[model samples]
Target chain A: MIDLQEMILEKDRLIPLLRKLKKESRLIAPVTNKHGDTLLSEINNIDRDTIDLDRQPQNSLKSFFLPQQEILAHYSVDTTGYNFTAPEAAKETIYFGVRSCDLTALLYMDLIFSKPAKDASYYDRRNRSVIITLGCNDPFANCFCEATNSGPYLDYGYDLQFIDLGSSYYVAAGRRKGADLLNKWDYFFRTVEEEDQKIRYQLFLEARGRFNRNIQVSHACHKLQEEEVAETIWEKLAGRCYDCGGCAYVCPTCTCFSVDDMAIDDSHGTRIRSWDACTSSGFTRMAGNHNPTDRTRHALKQRFLHKLKYDYQKHGKASCTGCGRCVDICFGGVDITTFIEMFTRDAS
Target chain B: MNTNFIPATAVIREIIRENDTISTFRLELINKRVPFSFRSGQFCMLSVPHCGEAAISISSAPNALPLFDLSIRNAGELTNAMHQMKAGEQVGIRGPFGTPFPMADFANSDMLFVAGGIGLAPLKSVIDHCLFQSGLEADAVANITLLYGSRSPSEVAFTTAISSWKEQGIDCRLTVDAGDDSWHANVGLVTELLQKELITKNTKSLICGPPVMIRFVIARLTEMGCASHDIFTTLERHMKCGMGTCGHCHLDGKLVCVDGPVFSLEQLQTMDVMELGT
Candidate 1:
């Protein structure tokens, strides 16, 4: 056993250590662009880009693993007959500065795509990646990961988890890949001291207390299981929803997608899978123009119920990681937290 | 890694045009890998060259092993494109997916089939399976009856199959919504054919039709003393992946693609499905 489990790295050694890791694999970290927004971007050069670990990235780890619109297979239609060839295998990459809630949602994605059969394209990208999550010391404004029990600091499901402790970082390796990374760059880190352990626990407690929103996620889940939400509640939510599909795009755990074939020429084209929102009428609209769900009353019904009610009953854990990205993204005031508040209130 | 979405090519052997809008395409897998088998009420995701895919029911019984029938109506882009395809042309086929009707339980019971327009596609699979079972099993399906209703006299499909069933002594009664000069049969909804004698608890009423007809037929059958679990019907949804992943066929907590394309009336009672009055 390597015993490369817990160690401390000085704050100054972060960039140089990432530069070393970048040489072997493609390094993706939260980088602050010129427009003043932090995003998880590929680092062209180690020191040239501004890798901001302080702010939460505008996007989750979804698009990196499951691109917005990726070609699943390329097909050629001619005299030879219709045949399809898969897209190229994913490149080996290191994902750095991900939040605990984001990584929690990735674990949920793993559960979703592996059913009747494994989604080939999703697995191709998911298998070749190393995830390094940054524990939220100072939680983001919209973050309710504390309520969801997915964050501030996660106990599991990350390759490597980093906790900022003043001048140094407390790094814990949750998997063999993370242990190898620690062993490979041993000089950048030092042994964890007794004082380091005390401060880490103290910071964890502080982070837990810092969350402003106390969403009744489990209460809502329970209420949904027992009785259906009042039709007026659904109507209120659906009435305000503009059907922009922005929340689903921003949400880390909403893994629903649609597959369609597009043509490049008369002979060849590609089969593509794109993100789909259950709120949209087109998500369930058949070819004959028959839609089972009336978008007026049921637009937000599927979205809320799937995460809180149905998924909870099926998985014993709700799909909502309480990242609260949807809370910030939805301008219509119909976020998951709003529904949960209304549901729990009405049920109580 | 890529075989998940890649559909195997199947050649269309024959196309039986039933009416102006409906046609039954007999397809055989060119490669015949492992020998594809599907129970009655299971469907396949058929792919057209330019068009993506649509979930269509396998209207044929398992006894027709290597060959299966897909009774498609000209309802959508892929279906319209399929209507234009000729015999000997190849099309992509993936899966014989979703839950199947429990033929073992049904083998001992009498069968009553109610169908409307293209809704007859999946019920036709069950009806034929019951007929096929009667020939094989010594304790076979006791009695069989089909009450099919079409939009009009011209819209009545599977006339050839209906004639064959009548010769085999199965009571095949049909009705049409609109009557023509040549039409000599009863003109009314198929629900009117629901005689009190046929609504026995032991008789499994398999229904597939328009949502409205299914609603009315089920109401009458239940009122006439048929048990909820004994009344089974297959559902049609806008499905992309015939597997459970795609959220298209999501009815309540259950995915219709996997949990069912075939659900009993008792099962339907729990869900807030649109097929019912809800």
Candidate 2:
């Protein structure tokens, strides 16, 4: 039996491993569909599908743990009483080729759902899912995970991780399940040699150099905690914000949600929890139409403060993963990187 | 789907009409595996079948087991639907969440409760708990002073319980913003009532009202020599999940559902947010 902790996979063995992963469990990977948009989607035909490792996927890893919308319970009311039944169990699936930024974001999400009160549904999906991450050897233009100390090359937060080598892939197991996968498919992996270790260390250093060095995520967080930022900065950010809620929808760490009970008929229905954004005016508005942060600027400030400052105070680290997905997707041009630039410009 | 978001069934035992738009509902948990117990100032997510849910405070004190009160006003969609709900109908309920009032701290202090409009709901729980305690717990409180105000005489909640509350040795003072012919009592704001009343050195003031009313009351209490630490208030925000997981109820990293719905002036001061304006 091969030691599953660290192993090497040849370029020729990649297709066989993919075929095995697809047949064993539900496999989701980054693939460009017929529409020419690359997304993390289920692989039905392994032979036809091509995985995209060049760029970060458009969507984050949140959907696998916390879905955009899900039914909490099925309810029925009659003359006797009310009855509520929990939804069916989640299916076991494997998410492959996830980037280090998403893997780190998953860790942040795990903390949010488990602490204070356990979200059973989130844990259910999380427990059943297997994550196989891919190391970022060539970082994206907007990528700055190094600033948050979350990625580029992750030390942890995956069952298995793959660091790309020219002729072969350096595979390492971070969990028991990953070791089990290697044990099951022993023919695909060879034991790591001394030369492979030297190459891995060299690749790690080169990957570190590829990130944007100007971004200072931790410094901005420190400045936010020390003193109040100017209101003009918030106003300027708010002016550009259209309140489209796209940033939150695309955000990996934003976990705000609202529950609604939809009726099937007079007697039966289901209660659903859908993704809700804090940037929206109606998020904090009370029943009597009393809103504390009524202005768009106030909401904008609240979002950044929660991400950059408030989360640091609560969790001892900022919530942002520096994936820069929001930077790439936000239509209003309200990005965290820009805010960090503005914050560090005059304040710190 | 999270089982934590699933609400247990609560049967409405009694619906007491407090006013035209507001009513006090007494609910009993039908399928509770564990006995439900909540202290005063904690709230529950009250949901109508098909309408929606709102974070409503538990109005009744801790004495009643299983059965609790939620005084709701016809303010928005979910609340308007709740008002239309009759006794014997079923509604969804989760929690008794948020930080409870500091009952232990106020044990030996002279209690001053200042309430305005629907803000009186949560404070009523604290007041009832203080007055209706058994044995040494009852004697722990020096005296109970309740200053309640509404928009009009007709809008006063818990009218039926007022006489009994007074009989139980509570110094209940009623006021209205503008009084009608029937209202022979004080025809001024509740904060003005604080001027005429004398506050002792050993007093702890609990104020709950509209944001404007709360601000003025806090100002009055400060002038009356009440320390910021001794004054407490309950805050309200739109909440979907009563648990801290949901970020909707967050007031500058402090999840109102978990960290507070109840916070002292000193506690709010420490949270460096502009809206709190500490």
The alpha-carbon RMSD values of the candidates against the true structure, listed in the order shown, are 1.3, 1.9
Model 1 misplaced regions, further than 4 Å: A1-4
Interface RMSD of each: 1.1, 1.8
TM-score, cand. 1: 0.98
True contacts kept of each: 0.68, 0.71
Model 1 residue-pair collision total: 0
lDDT of candidate 2 over A44-151, digit per residue (tens): 888898778776888988887778988888888787777778998888899998988888888988889887777888888889888999998888888888988888
DockQ values of all predictions: 0.76, 0.69
Each model's TM-score, in the order given? Answer: 0.98, 0.97
Quality of model 1 by C-alpha lDDT? 0.89
Q: Per-residue CA lDDT of candidate 2, range B137-231, in tens?
A: 54477888889889998888888777788888788889998898899889899988896355988889998888888888888888888998999
Q: Pick the candidate with the highest TM-score.
A: 1
